[model samples]
Target: MPENTPYSLPKDSKAWQQAVDSIASLLPEDISLHDFDALQSLPVFALIVVLPAKVPALDIHHYVQSWVDEQPSWHLVTVAEDAEASFVDVDVATNGSTGTQQPFTPAQVFRYLLVPVTDTLMHPGKKTAAAHIIDDQLTTRLRHDLAKNYANAQATDHPENAALVHDNLVDCHILSIGHMLRTHKLACFDMDSTLIEQEVIVELAKTAGVGAEVEAITEAAMRGEIDFDESFVKRVALLEGISTSVLDEICARLTLSTGAHTTITALKALGYHTVLVSGGFSYFANYIAKQLGIDEVHANHLDIEDGQVTGHIQLPIVNGAKKAAIAQHTAEHLNIEMSQVVCVGDGANDLPMMAIADLGVAYNAKPIVQARADAAVNVTGLEGVLYALGYPALVASKS
Candidate 1:
């Protein structure tokens, strides 16, 4: 009612227009407004404004406090820079009365865990048990329950003893959270030993009768014990005398890792631009991409001569650095920020691309890869990623 107070005005009111205009005018020229919403459920008037990132000089607290000095019951406001950040209002009634109220801070800490669905059904208390280990006061929400018998949980106020909590849960596979979980747009995957169950080259080697030799090289390279390029050349040389038809046989037998299809389907359905970047040959990556309906594919090309393997690969191999570059290039092409990309792989070479992505998930990865990744998924299949992104069980099931 006072002229100096910050009061709530009707959406159509000129007062509201002036307030919006004033805020916009105060923002820096480079800063852009992303979203603004009025709280409809809250009893008191409140507004939430979303910006791109933190701004040092944009202090709305001082502006609102000055107005509050005049009109005690005017309105409350908050600003958030993170796109996925949200606020939840909590009201507590004292002495069994409903009028008095207090608000708690927004839920900042987030936890992600995976448990066997059968275990959860058999022991429903397991969910509560895991929650207690994180934070007794916090609540856990079901993110996803895969058809493969695993379920994902998201919780607030995650404890500092997160690793201990994960260790306590017998069936729990992954436990991770933070900015990476909230903001990811693209999902990139490595081909060999990641999306698929085995290395295509090793399979080809088996057909060439050099399986033992090639497999050893592949393992050493993936473990980061040997240079990928050097290992690739040695492995390819072993397949030189093998006929090109071996590729068809290998592709026919290529088995996707558990939940690979479901994971890609869910990611695409959620509006992610899926890509397959591999050090493996396009001979296999292209076929897999088509079958999986991936949006993009980048991989090496194996040289062939006279209907047989030439034992030589094309230049500019899709090594770790190349994979990272492709991931960045794809993000630019999609016009999405790098913070929106999620990369998943299993070997050392996949580390570079994973590092560039907002969330790097090691899917049954080697020790070195897992150590460097933002998160690791060992027990569940690829679909576990939906849980990492905080998708609800029902939502992933529907996908």
Candidate 2:
């Protein structure tokens, strides 16, 4: 390679060694360096050395499978290219020269191999770690070079038609594998309009014989016409003294919007720390969470006395703002950045939580929410949420 080539190594034929040195200097000095030469043969096109929020060695990729299996977002980028895809094993040794080689998995992007999820790179400690000294300009330049290279590969050799390919890229490069590989965390979701399904509440209320009244309140609350707190109080009060068992009956009659189940299940398997933050009651939320093995559940707790509702709700109803608070609390407890969290909801009440999460998904949500969310999914199943998080393939059915 020419001396001026951007990806070139030093004149000493020690590009890998020098790269190791640079990487070592950024990590703990007590750590050793293993053989880095094997990494030279692969095309990494770009590299992003980031500081993890917490749990520096956290294996984020393990939780990333669902996104790939479900939405297959990254496939869009590769679809635009003719480059052969391959995986390369890279060993990241923190223990200086004495470090032993431990198997590290990295995806080779064209010529550039990436260590996308490195908890060690971002030392999560009270004091700033030594690795922070890498020149920002150098890192930025390296990433830009990578993005440029990938862009070229997709534009030129990609097999799909130009227009369709162009349309896909234009719609979102954020969902591409490059972005996912570059991203530290992913947020998955349930759709059926929980993040976007249009009228789950209204439809259900119809069966409950309170469609018109419930629909009016839903409309008002969603339009931000009435205080969410007050609207919830009024709405639930209308359901007062209704049979608590009616909820189970409601579940039997419930109809999930197009993508509800698939999206939730896939995200759960992928380790997104999924939560059923719903405006709906515990009746449905609990069932959905249990079936999907969701890590958290937040919904209206039906105030029941003697197998019947007390004609009242438990104080501090789970409304829009409360939903947001729960999500924030989870992020804090996990010691993760809010950006690592995801919130999905459909109604006006869901807006608060959606607004607060790192990636708010307006799943089949109200138009107002759709306008405000970080992303939106209109795909047939909740699985569309997997796509929003940058997965490009459908999850294999688990028996």
Candidate 3:
């Protein structure tokens, strides 16, 4: 690699001095460099570099293929220098695929700037060869090759990546770039019907022969037809006379949702703060949390004395608003942006908290909940979340 300057320009930096210096050394002498903005708002690393003089509009379409093959990260967003027109501002989005973004890794970043200097841009003398050798056909071919390489890498690196596998299987046209996984610092999950299969209230009510009644309310609560707080109180009241041992029984029989284990494990591995916030009973929540290795559990505490339900809750029922409060609290405590947190549930009450989270997911939720959530999954497993996070099917399956 040639000893070239890296794109070390920070967001706040006024000029990409190195990029400008390089551009000036190659392009026509009249083409002067100007200011540029690091479009940080985008999910991918994009920069909108501006120039005072009009850029070359030559139909050097032949260079497109070479540029694509040689510089996968560079895309000609536009070619103009008009001040009032946004088209004049070049939108340069980074190809964060395997090779491009790898240089920005922690290890690479610490090892001095790893600039991408190819033989094409090397200095032969005072004036360097212009990179204007690109054409439309070449550009098209390059894009196709880059996309193929990206897909192949995805398959090789993450065979179980569900979305990629699904797309490939269906032969869907995968967009070049879209949603980027935001840095989520916190994650919140709903207990019953989401994290775990069993609803503690309905199961406990089974012992009292009121299973049908409590279940109806549970279903209604999840469907968003009934008030979560009221429905919960009515259900708990039915289970008041049951023995506390049943809690353990329910815990023993509880089944974790598909992908729950992998999702939580992966999130934890990535240093994400997770919480189990549920409208379900704490008895089952606490036990299931332990089994799944969760960091926090927030649910309704059953009022049991002498190993029997008192037919009443202790205090502070975990309602919809309360759930949202807990999620916000965790985000604030972790000093993470709200957008860096994810809340997931499958019930109507979960809507409040889900709305507050940076990313809200409705896992096999009722129609009402699904419509309100940012993302909804109707599948049998929790792994669908991996898709929303842009984890190709292969990676999700592996973990």
Leading candidate by TM-score:
1
Model 1 poorest ten-residue lDDT run: 139-148
Give residue 294's lDDT in candidate 3 (0 to 100). 91
TM-score of every prediction relative to native:
0.58, 0.53, 0.57
User: Please, what are the lDDT tens digits per residue for candidate 2 over residues 1-399?
Assistant: 111111110111223233344443333444444422222222211222221111122222322232334432111012221123221111111222212211111111111112222213322221111112111323333344434444555467663522222111111112111222322233423322453333445545565578799879878887778987787777766665566556665554444444343444444444456666666667666765664456677777767788766646676777777777777787777778765676666667777777766456565456687656655544233444444454433321122
TM-score of the candidate numbered 1? 0.58
Model 2 scores a C-alpha lDDT of: 0.44
Give the residue spans of candidate 2 off by over 4 A.
Answer: 1-208, 395-399
The full ranking of all candidates by lDDT, starting with the best, is 1, 3, 2
Give the candidates in order of TM-score, highest first. 1, 3, 2
lDDT of 3 by residue, 40-156 (tens): 111111121111111221222333324435665443332122223111111112221111211111110000011223212233221111211222233244345434544665667
lDDT of each: 0.56, 0.44, 0.53
The candidate 2 region of ten consecutive residues with least summed lDDT is: 1-10
Cα deviation of 90 in candidate 3 (Å)?
A: 40
